[model samples]
Target: MSSEEEGCFVNILSRNISNIVDALLHGPENAFDEARKEGLLEREDLDRITNKESNGDKIRACLDIIEGKGNEKRICEKCGQEAAKRCVTCGILCCDQHLKRHQQEGHNLMDPGVKIEKLRCTVHGDLFKFYCMDDWSLICPKCKDGQHKEHEVVPMGTAPNKLKVVLAEKHCRVLKSIESNESQLHEVQEEEGQTQNAGRGAEDLLEKRRKELCQIVNETVDLMKGQINKRKMEKLSLLGKQKEKLEQQNESLHQEKSSLQTALQEELDTASFLQGSKDLLKRLETMSDFKSVERTPLPVLDFSKEEKNLDGLITLNKNFLEKIEKGPVEHPEKVELDQNNLRRLYGRSPSLDPNSAHRQIKISGDLRTATLTRTGNQYPEHPDRFDVHPQVVSCDCFSSGRHYWEVDVRSSRWWKIGICLNSMGRKGGKSGLGANPESWCLSKLNNEFSAYHNKQRTSLSVPGDHERFGFFLDCEAGELTCFGDSRVLHVFRGNFMDPVKPAIGVWDYYCDSVHFVHLVKQTFITN
Candidate 1:
């Protein structure tokens, strides 16, 4: 079709559509409602909302709005207008004006038909029964007299007071629920706004990435095409060189033939010339054999592979950028909780003696080749940093000044270990607890996070579970075995650099086979 004709048709169709929309919007009773609600509803919108299939939905929505369902009701009690069913007992009402006052006044009223009924006496008609001193129901006056009247009787005034207290409690609970739900709703709205902002950020990133991709594509096209052209030129130059070589060979052959003809003029030299010419021709033939050299192929970008890698990198970049914008890193403090230190902190172990300051834990070979073994807590004074380790652990730094150690549980004995770190060196500060800083997986699996510390075992590698919390020191690349002789419950790993420092270690309660073998030197982990 002609462009002009297409444009004319599009304009006519658009006008017709607008007219049809106007008619559809202003068609019926709800047409006015729609106009007031959201201006005019176009024909397409009307069709979607008022189709036969959606009639039930429309009716339900209308009922919800008209009948005040799924909406809060506020009315003025003084005006007596049926604003909403704010209270069933008092029939409280409100309008736009005095709604707040009515809400405050009628909010304390008891629910209709919800009050406890009086237990009437069969013998004495009007007087209500009284509650017994014991945890029993109310008794009539006659029954009280017959049952020997010593039981406590709630006074008439007491009933009202008790009911008021109960009702107040109920109202407070309702208010609290409303308040809590509103607070949660506000938080959700804020979170939603943040998510939308993140989406906008993602869109902006996508646009930037699109520009970069376009630039890359243009550059790639140029490079690839230029490479192909360069290959073509190289092939042409090689072919020209081969042609020159062939021409030189042909000329030399022609010269040899002419020399042979000159020699053939003498009969005696004829045979020799012919033989020599044949040899020369053979040599010429060998030189004329040109090996077909293939031209180098163009470099393939493997754009698909590159595109996948770029996609991953871009996604990571977007995530990283968003994280940087979000900004949640202020740096958290860590605690080093080992056996000797834990016991000392918990008042089990004693403090190091000032008089006999020679108490020491031995350090031998390099952490990688040597072993990190603990004797027991030698201190006899301070119990604040006490722990329940099977042996006392004191740290010894290796020659390289690297701290490495291991914790070996006694045997297949049932035990547990816990570990904590105190990076701030605060004596009594708040900290998370349990073996791991995650969840509480119960029974044979329940794990919880709790903050705790130990004082005696100042700095040592520790590793353990919640039930048996202990500090952990990085062992060799060997598997970390647990529980029993079977390797079934082992945590396997590869190798890592751990000689940097001696980390706190938490280990099993039993002294069975628990051993710490450091790969480097010992690290003195102090504040």
Candidate 2:
């Protein structure tokens, strides 16, 4: 075909492109394949059309490709004559002689040289003059009278202004979220640096202790040094994981903000802009529900008290070297509660307080188990609720007498079982199990166990497989002791000035429920 003739054919295709796209979209699933087999579409064009998410968008893209390839000779579909006019309603090419007959039948007609913009509703075949706010769609007058009758409809011209306000607000929120993520990332990096410095300091202290004990007990010094190094590595590992998580969150926020900015800068029509903005805004809202990372001082190793005890032992026993020649000597025995003592100390099982639970914590129907969830719960705002950590406290508090409790932690690998002052902070970084001065906890993080109090950690030597843990608190003696299956793990000594409640925390989503064991006399058994 000649270039002039091809131009005329292209104009005819472009004039009724919307109708052609609509027919192809609703025709069949193999329409693109058929077009490709007929040599009207190329392989790359088919691939491009397939990339579109919606059927309408795919057909429109295909029509664009076909229109660009409009160099073949064409004839009027009605008669064996050169096509000169196009029907807008039926999307058929017809010569001027046959066009007059179609015009008499009330079909819209357009010249080959006239280019038509697709502004008509596909369903109603009327020009879209209204925008439906409820559905975020464009509608015609007939559509407004039918399905969109109760919708918030406005003139198409005014819809862009309303959408601009919404997009602006969403843009501001995304910016703020990006800023918040950046701030958290900074805090995590700082914590990481502090942790490294603290680790070096602890190593130095360990070196000094090694020298002091090298002369009297070389084997014990090596063991202590190994424990210190292991603890340091664990601390650094935990901080590294936290830093990585914060970095990923910040990266996601940046991408979301970039997409929003691109949409704002594009010269899209009102309908396209509204649809794109609606999707972006929904995603922005979801991504904006970010939780702040809890900032706590990294725990450091303090073997000063242990060093003093070892020094005292060395001074008191001159035959310690002879005893070391035999197998490993036994240290002072830890208090192991028998079945009778356990039964005597066992009090009523304490239930978790829903109001004190974090939004990601789900309290069970029995009120004794607290489980971590991937999504936040629709919890009502309460002053005692923990906002930063996935932690919760018991409903009852102990003040005057001795109290005993057991937690079934068989299902979780990372958990904290402890007691905190009833007046402890509940909304900040220090609200965690043992982050503040008002709490004491024995935590099992991965394979390591440690006792935490006032942000200081004392590494405990305990078996990792112990599933049930017992806590015995003597308020009068100002002592809180944690016991594994057979032996006491660690103890925290402090003046009990206020009532304390049992608390539990779960850090990871993979962790299961931390249950408060209900003590029954019939099945009472203790290790």
Candidate 3:
């Protein structure tokens, strides 16, 4: 062959080897070693390739194809838990839910111990619980004198001894039979070995081959036993849970039965007591007739000494009364209004959406940055504090500061301006923690500014505060003014902030249905 052609063949061989190696390295791990140990791969042909053949690559490839690619996963029909393949009768696939149904419907349910012999006593019909020995009979204890006394009495505890004696006799018979059978088996085995050795080389080779066959069979038997054990454990686990459930149900029924019995007893007692009471009432009525209606009264007399003691006691009580009167007169009661109660009395938005129950939050697109107009009760003597409490009233899906609405006011009066979000409390308590930030109204540039600059909004106190728990609300810019008894709040428009989508959490926690009110550019609509 040309050198170039030879080099090409070598290259092809090397590439094929490399590909095969890569597949083994990265491929599934269902190696045939496990199959061999478990005796599934015990055929002489398979053994020849794996142990005798010098070609390692060919053997590994054969093993991989056989063990790695099969879809033999035994999934439970109920829970889908994987199980080793086994006979369906073994019940490996059943989960707790399905196994309970099996116990009720399957012919072979969980273990019910040996079927006990039932021989009733001649006298009572109760359960027959004992066994007699001499006659090999079953009977209740009461039957001892009637029927079982003539029999040599042996307790059931000594049953093993009786069984042993019977088994010993059988063994003697079986030993004789086995001796005869062994002679026949020996002849058969020798003949069989000779027949097999016709093809094989020597006696030792044949014997070794025979032993290997036995070992393979034994390995298969062991694998079967392992499968059976695994199946039984799974079934027992399922049954344990079902049994626990049934036990709970049984206990409940027993308690109900006990309660019924007690109730019946109580009713019987009540009826008996009522009848006895009726008899006593009749006796009392009859006795009343015997008493005189208007006879000479028993003498009414009082001792003079006792009368003087009573007078002394009355005088002491009079002095005590005078001392009590001389002391200060205590106020009867003072009425006060619960501030939180007043806030509850001040209700929220007219209607609530049904989805509100699930805490579904939505962005408040309507009311954004509104001028801090002096609300009902927080207006101060001076009004410059409206700008002092610059606030975001509501927000939309976008949350860039650029898209925000701004509110400003220039009023000469000193005012206590505030910012607040309109939100409801969870479970009707305070929103924000225990304190409600839903109805938050900020303090003006009043003495409270120094008091609350460092503290949280919940800590900021209003004398007549309502439910105002405050959190961060991205707001749009707007403006408002305050004068006389009236105040005006306004929203000056701009594009919404870019890119800040609505938060699923804060939106659901905050506003209800928000109503947007756009006033003509410059109008005081306040009354």
Pairs that clash in candidate 2? none
Please give, for residues 1-527, the per-residue lDDT of candidate 1 as tens digits.
33333223222322343343354445534443543354322344344445534444544333222223212323233453334323322333334454555445533222212211222344564233344433234455676776637765553223334433433443344344435434444444444343333323333344455665554433333333343334334334444554454444445444544543443344432112222334433443443232222222211212232223335442333333343333222112332334333222211111111221112222223221111225543545533232332212223321111121233333313322322221212122222122232101111212322222222111222234422322222323222212222112322232222211122222332233323332221111111
Global Cα lDDT for candidate 2:
0.69
Worst 10 residues of 3 by lDDT: 518-527
Q: What is the C-alpha lDDT of each candidate?
A: 0.31, 0.69, 0.30
> Which segments of candidate 1 are over 4 A away from where they belong?
1-119, 122-126, 131-139, 142-153, 211-527
Instruction: Residues 1-527, candidate 2: write the lDDT tens digits.
Output: 35444545454445656665765676534645654564544578667776788886886676565455553544566664666765655666688788887767755454543333455788877766777877778788999999999989987667777777766777787677668767877876876676565535544654566566545555555444554555556667866887787777778877876886787788865556765776776676666354434433344444443444444433523354443444232222332455345544344488999999999999999999999899999999999999999999998777644567889988887898899988899998878888889999988887899999989999989855888888887766788878887578887998763678899998885437898998653211111
Residue 344 lDDT (model 3):
24
Error of 1 at 321 (Å): 23
Candidate 2 local lDDT, residue 149: 99
Write candidate 3's Cα lDDT for 1-527 as tens digits: 33333223222322344454444444412333444454444455244444533445554554343322222332334455442221122323344555665445421221111111122244664324344554445455677666787876543334334534543443344344434434444443444344333322322333343444444333332332333334334334433444444444344434433433333334332112222233333432343322212111111111222222222332333334343343212211421222232122211121112222122222232322122222322323322111222222222222222111112222211222222222332333232221332232223333232111113443333343222221122223321111111112212122222222111111111222222222221110000
Which is the leading candidate under lDDT?
Answer: 2
lDDT of 3 at 136: 47
RMSD of candidate 1 to true structure, Å: 40.1
> Worst 10-residue stretch by lDDT in candidate 2?
326-335
lDDT of 3 at 269: 22
